[model samples]
Target: MIVEHRIYTTHPGQVHEYLALYEAEGLAIQKRILGRMVGYYRSEIGGLNQVIHLWAYADLAERDQRRAALLADEGFRHYVRKITPLLAGQESRILVPAPFFTPTWQD
Candidate 1:
């Protein structure tokens, strides 16, 4: 499996807005396109000013397809436009899961 992590840095004084927007708007759109959200977080320590979220994908191909579909979605486009003014910086990474990791809780 693949894990995609995105770390977003919000503009000063905009952290709450960023988090609120994600909760009220972004999460649902993301759930529709991305499937398997591992977590979403706001830093309380060294990564202050950051918002991190993770999603799992079957493979690179699937990830690419889903990302493309998400980018093409009109709602996502509107969402992006809505959040553009609040962003400071962004970073993303794709990681391979270790063999011990499993999608199901029983694993």
Candidate 2:
């Protein structure tokens, strides 16, 4: 399995606004398409105004397909329009777990 780690740095004081927008508009659409959310988190320490989340996929191909579907959805596009102005930066990483570490939970 592969894990996609996403981090969004919101504009200075806009973390709450961003989170509210995501929870209200984006989460359901993403959950419907992505299907394997590992977790969602907000920064409380080192990086202020940061939102982080993880999603797991069987492989890069599956990830690409789902992401394409999500992007093509009208609801997701609307949500992106609403949230983009609040974001300062965005980063993503694809992670591979070690052979011994098994991920037992998803969604």
Which candidate achieves the best TM-score against the true structure? 2
Q: Write the per-residue lDDT of candidate 2 for residues 2-104, one digit (tens) a residue.
A: 9999999999999999988899999999999999999999999998999999999999999999999999999999999989999999999999999899988
Q: lDDT (CA) for every model shown?
A: 0.86, 0.95
Kindly list the per-residue Cα lDDT of model 1 for residues 37-76, writing each as its tens digit.
8888888889678899888888899889999999999988
Q: RMSD of each candidate?
A: 1.9, 1.2
Worst 10 residues of 2 by lDDT: 98-107
Question: Cα miss at 49, model 1 (Å)?
Answer: 1.0
- Candidate 1: 10-residue stretch with minimal lDDT: 98-107
> Candidate 1, which segments miss by more than 4 Å at Cα?
105-107
Relative to the true structure, candidate 1 reaches a TM of: 0.91
- Residue 19 in model 1: shift from native, Å? 1.2
In model 2, how large is the Cα lDDT of residue 93?
100
